[model samples]
Target: MKRTIFQSIREYKKQSILAPVFVVLEVLMEVLIPLQMAKIIDVGMAGDGNLPYIIKMGIILVVMAMLALIFGAVAGRLAAQAGAGFAKNLRHDIFYKIQDFSFHNIDHFSTSGLVTRMTTDITNVQMAYMMTIRLMARAPIMIILSLIMTLTINAQIALILLITIPILGGILIFIAKKAHPHFIKVFDEYDVLNNSVQENVNASRVVKAYVREDYEIEKFHGISKVVFNLFTKAEKIVAWNSPVMQFTMYAVVLLMVLIGGKSIIFQTMETGELTSVIVYALQILMSLMMVSFVFVMIMIAEASADRIKEVLNEVPEMQNQPNAQKTVKNGDIDFDHVDFSYAGEGGNLSLKDVNLHIKSGQTIGIIGGTGSAKSTLVQLVPRLYDVTKGSVKVGGVDVREYDLEALRDQVSMVLQKNVLFTGTIYDNIRWGDENASNEEVQRVCKLAQADGFVQEFPRGYQTKIVQGGNNVSGGQKQRLCIARALLKKPKILILDDSTSAVDTKTDALIRKAFREEIPNTTKIIIAQRISSIEDADQIIVMDDGKINGIGTSEELLKTNEIYREVYLSQVKGGEDDEK
Candidate 1:
């Protein structure tokens, strides 16, 4: 997983390497300053006024301090540059990978989970990367060099660090192991909290219509409380880190003072050597604290790295075969003994042994009750999901043999749920064909019976649409969506109950325009209203993932039991409304 994530640091490899080199230089300057201080105290102040020698060592100390400051500043700038660049490239790669995901791949992950991985998880990894390059180098080099300096001054005081370091190290390790699992649980809770906010914002109108704002607030509070408690549990364990380090630091300092004071009284160690030993002891203990801080960051980043690796290493479930067919010849579709299941091979099939053929330039209608797999059947023609048993062919070629982009370009599907992005009406329709002319855009809107209401606005086609087209009525949104699909000029057009929101007269006009203007394109309509499909060339009756009937309306009235019952009930209801 680390190998996969580090590959995103493409162009910033130079900066990543240079930052640590400067950190090493800064550590060297810091260690030498203590040695210079020992010289100033012993050689210059030994005889009651070697004033020239003291001034010389003091100037050297100031120069070393300034050089250390310059190196530290340069290292920090380089680390920031490398970290921000790596994050940008990583986000770019993850988004491109998501674009290639098939329907099956998308179903395996929740929307909120993927969003968190791209955003919060990546931020954690970036911080860890920056610290690993800078502080990881600075802490160890400072510890090793400081220990060497202390040993040369006095061996007895240096032994205090050797013993105290291990005891402090053990405490940090125990605290890290206990706090890590809580951090993992805290991130998982973040996904649920984000999902709750997303749902409430998207369905704000429904909540207001039902006056359920209080209920939504209570539900959100419940999820937020879980996240808060998990974070608190993790932080409480980490809180032990500071006080333990302080106690260890103070205790080691006192031990150094007591041992060095005894040596001074016995005339074994000089005053200059004792002063340098105290400075080295403080440096070594502070470096250990920095190590503990880096370790904690690594624990959190390890959890986040696993999530990011899952997205980067995911092989797309579908891809084009070698030398795949590039062009769709015509709109003829055939489903030959096809069986499909959402749960791969061993699960219950949503579409069962479906056999149907549609000719080029023919208009077909499909009718079924709820959950009868109406949308599932049309989704196969565009190769949204592959068949498990048999094959789905478009233009007499198996869908798997065709390039995915070429096949989907010819088959335009306006789904059951109409969606419009935030843009002007012209901009939204232009998504169908970006190169379409202004006249071409207006023509399709007229055919879909959308131009009348759109012209009622002062800006005509240039009126801005709010998010999700919330400013428009349901029927207006439906008509605008139909106009967008018509601009595609595809070889095959599938409308899955898309006209349910419009009135009967407008629906008939749209169908009439399809018949007169684009008669050569194959059309498929799935509808709940019988009036919508009564005039089709042939209608299909589906029940329970199987074809129950297939014939003309007149023939189905006498032959198919399911079609006869549905037709009689609708006709009688129309007569009652008239009376």
Candidate 2:
């Protein structure tokens, strides 16, 4: 896991390495300052007031201080650079990995979970990385060097630290062990908190229409309170750090003063030597305290690191076969004895033993009630989800054998709940074919019956679409999405209930344009309204994860009970409307 997360520190290796080097230099300067002070006090102050020697030592001290400040500043800047750069690369890798994930892989993670991992989890890792490079490096070095200085000046007094150090170390270990579990629980709750905010924001309109704002607020507060309690528990455990550090520091200082004063009185230690030993003792204790602080951060970051590694270690379930086919030859689709389950093998099936064949350039319409697996069937053509058993073939080759990008480029799918990004209408349509010319874009919009209403806007194609295209009517959003798909000019176009919002007249015109203009394109339409698919060359009726009937509309009207019942009921309803 550590190896996986640290792999994102690609270009920042130099900064990461150099930051610690400067930290060493800074610690050296700080350690040397106390030794110099001992000299200034002994040789200068006590040696009959040697004025010139005192001035020389004072100047040297100032130089050391300035150098220490310079080294510390450079180390801080480099650490910041390394941390921020590492975060950017990590986020890039995570996002690209998500793009490669199949729908099956994506189902294992929630949208808000991914968001928290990329944003909050990565931020925590970044801070820990910076501390590891800077303070972590400084603390240990300072402790070792300070301990050496103290032992050199007075070994008997230094033994106090050895005793106090372990006592403090044991306390810290206990705090760390107890606090870590709470931190893990805290970050997991962060996922729930973020998910709550995301769902409420996305469904703001529905909540308002139903007048459920108070309910949403109460639910949000419930989630927030859980997060708050978890974080409080973790922090309360960590709060033991400061008091423990203070007591250890004071105890060490008291022991040093008493022992050193007795030694000085017996003439075994000079005043200057006693002062330097005290300074070194303080440095050692301070370094230990800094170590404890870094330890706490690592404990928190350990949980975050695991979350990040979860994403980085995930292997995309779908990938191109070796020596994969690069180009799709045609739109011919063949589903051979296909059986699929959302759960892995040996689970309840969503699509069961479905066998069907679609010729290139044929217009196929599928009508099914909810839970009929209509969308699931077309998703297989683009290799969105691989079949659990048997094979799905496109252009006479198994879909798994084709390069994922190449196959998806030729198969354009406009879903029932299609999405539009916040951009101009031109920008949204150009997502289909980025290199398409202005004339080509306008032509597809015309075919989709979107150009007329689009032109009615003051800015025509340049009009800005708000988030989710909320400013537009439902039919307008659907037509604009159709225009975007038409711009792809793909070999196979799948419309999964995409035209339900448009009126019958507009829908018929769009289909008429498809017949006249793009007759070679294979079109598949999934719709609830029978009128939408009555004129189709071949219509499929699906029921309970199986194909109940497959024929032209007229043939199905006579032979298929489900199709006949639906057709007569719709026809009667139309006559009643006329009355």
Top TM-score model:
2
Candidate with maximal lDDT: 2
lDDT of 1 by residue, 64-178 (tens): 9999999999999999999898889889988999999999988877888899988998898888889889998998898889888888878877778878878888889889889
Which segments of candidate 1 are over 4 A away from where they belong? none
lDDT of each: 0.90, 0.91
Q: List clash counts for every candidate, in order.
A: 0, 0
| Residue-wise C-alpha lDDT for candidate 2, range 1-579, written one tens digit per residue | 288899999999999999999999999999999999999898899847999999999999999999999999999999999999999999999999999998888888999999999998899889989988999899889988988888888998878877877788789878877888988898888989899899898889999999999999999999899988988887898899889888888888888889989998998888888888888888887887777777878888888989888888889999888899998999999999999998979989999999999999999999988999999999999988889998999899999999998999999999889899999999999999999888888998999999999999999999999987888999999988888998888999999999999999999999999899989889999998898899988999999999999999889988999999999889888999999
Pairs in clash, predicted candidate 1: none
The all-Cα superposition gives candidate 1 an RMSD in Å to the true structure of: 1.8
